[model samples]
Target: MKTSTPVGTQADQLQVTEDGKPLDAVRGTRAGDLDLRRTVLWWKGFEEQVVSRQQELHGIGEDVVLAAQAADTALQESPPRLAGEVFSAVAEGFSTVPGEVPRLLVPWFAELARSIGREVSTRSLADAAGAGVTAVQRAGAPPAGTPSLLDALVPAAEALVGAEAAGVPAVAALHAAYRAAADGTRRTVEDGTVDPGALLVAWFFERGTVV
Candidate 1:
């Protein structure tokens, strides 16, 4: 992956290109990188917003961080069970409540989707789920389908948000999660058994269940 600093953009801003052409595999790679950068910028700006609206952001921030911590802990302590539970929850939940969505989380998830691929939308539960999974994949998840990917991604995400919640630098935390997820995925795949949970989860998500 060759990189170049584009003219007229921020001096440090890189336009990640494939050779001389724009990267487009797995959803317009260059554009996705740019968009992800934009999301990072937005999060940076959100710090200022948080200062201005402490009451609103505090709870949300805590919750996000805590979720990451929980997921991380679960993955480390019980990778198999965690894989099963997460898979079952998403799969079963989607089947019953295909349109289920987190309260007031549309914008946040939308940003996540955009950071991975330029055109994914959060309006549909299936799309939203795909975007979340894809973002995890792009962050360094294995090439496997949903179950294995989630096994890697869930914990890394927990660390990502947990670091931010602890006031760690946002970009650093994100990059860390990416590396961690990729490494974990590689190890899990080497174990040679797809946790049943991961399989079920992948099955449901691919089945087009909502939520």
Candidate 2:
């Protein structure tokens, strides 16, 4: 379905004020708190391993891509299901991890398929999560083991499915998954099993530019 409104324009309109401050202002403050060097390193690795080779990494089906595009179009044209404040938060959260919007469509499509009573395999979800772990390693992060990363990514995929089932906007559902994944990354970092630099790489896949 064609959208009369451009996606960027629609996204811009959704950026409303929260507590008398624009959401972007809030995001900017949050962004300032992050480690710039680590963030840049992570983005570089992700851009090379994941964003630059999304199709090769994820192996997403054409049908899923089409479905995700259609859903995004619908969101662009229709009024948002979430309140402005909530929508802005979701948008900001998703935007934190660049290039995640498209990769996330894989799980989003899975949810839509299941909603229509189509049987979706759990293996498909596992593959998606595993791909992310592989991307992190390829991005120059030390080997943190697949199981630890999967422990975080698997639930993140589930969060996307759950958010979709709750009738949230596609963008918001993607953000939900990102938040879950970010939480996992945070825990992994805290455990000291993974480097802080690795958090940046994981954030990109869990959520980068080429070096």
Candidate 3:
């Protein structure tokens, strides 16, 4: 029997490409040099454009920082089974008894569906939410013929509903929804469909009016 190459080693030797061109060819530079330059530039841009701006906007207040830290810690400590139960309840509720959705949330859901290349409507959203709930309750993979984007939308819907159930403040619930949508965008990108940046921007534009 032949032995297989280690996954990590194979990944390390894999050549990543953009538009079918190797990074070096695309950049017209040595790959290693380009990689280092890109890494440094990304870090600098993140610090200056994200961290600095956030600090300025939030004033680096201890209360805000502590609250954020606490949330992160709680999320990290949550057991997967418990989290799944919470997500399942939210999904089920949306599918069965999503009461009088605020008018604002509909547009956000429509935009999110459109961003993921799906037609949007109350019925379709309810169906997707129902499918998600069924999948969770069965403790198995999603049913055959399930749309791929459900992998993202289910969690995004769960986050929104869960926030509401927890009685999170309105502003915080909106933020949670946006964050969940961002996470969903990331998942689609990893699935090799949807432009991450474009989807993220779509979510951001809808964020203000959601919840």
Give the per-residue lDDT of model 2 (tens digit) for 1-211: 2224343432222222223333221121222111323333322333333333234223232322343334334435553332222222222333233243333333322332223221112233333444544554454333333324444455566675576457554334445555666555544432223322323323443321111
lDDT of 3 by residue, 139-209 (tens): 44333223233344456566656765675543344345445554554443322333322232223323222
lDDT of 1 by residue, 1-211 (tens): 2233233331111111222333221222222122323433333232222233223222243433333334334434543221123322222222332121211222324434334343212222223334565554554444544435466445555555555456543334444454445444333432233332232222222111111
Those runs of model 3 whose alpha carbons end farther than 4 Å from true positions after fitting are: 1-148, 190-206, 209-211
Q: What's the TM for model 3?
A: 0.28
lDDT of 3 at 137: 31
- Single out the weakest 10-residue window by summed lDDT for candidate 2: 25-34
Per-residue lDDT value at 162 in model 1: 58
What's each prediction's TM-score?
0.28, 0.31, 0.28
Pairs of residues at least 3 apart in sequence or in different chains that clash in candidate 1: 68-158, 84-197, 98-210
Which candidate number maximizes lDDT?
2
Candidate 2 Cα errors over 4 Å, as ranges: 1-147, 190-202, 205-211
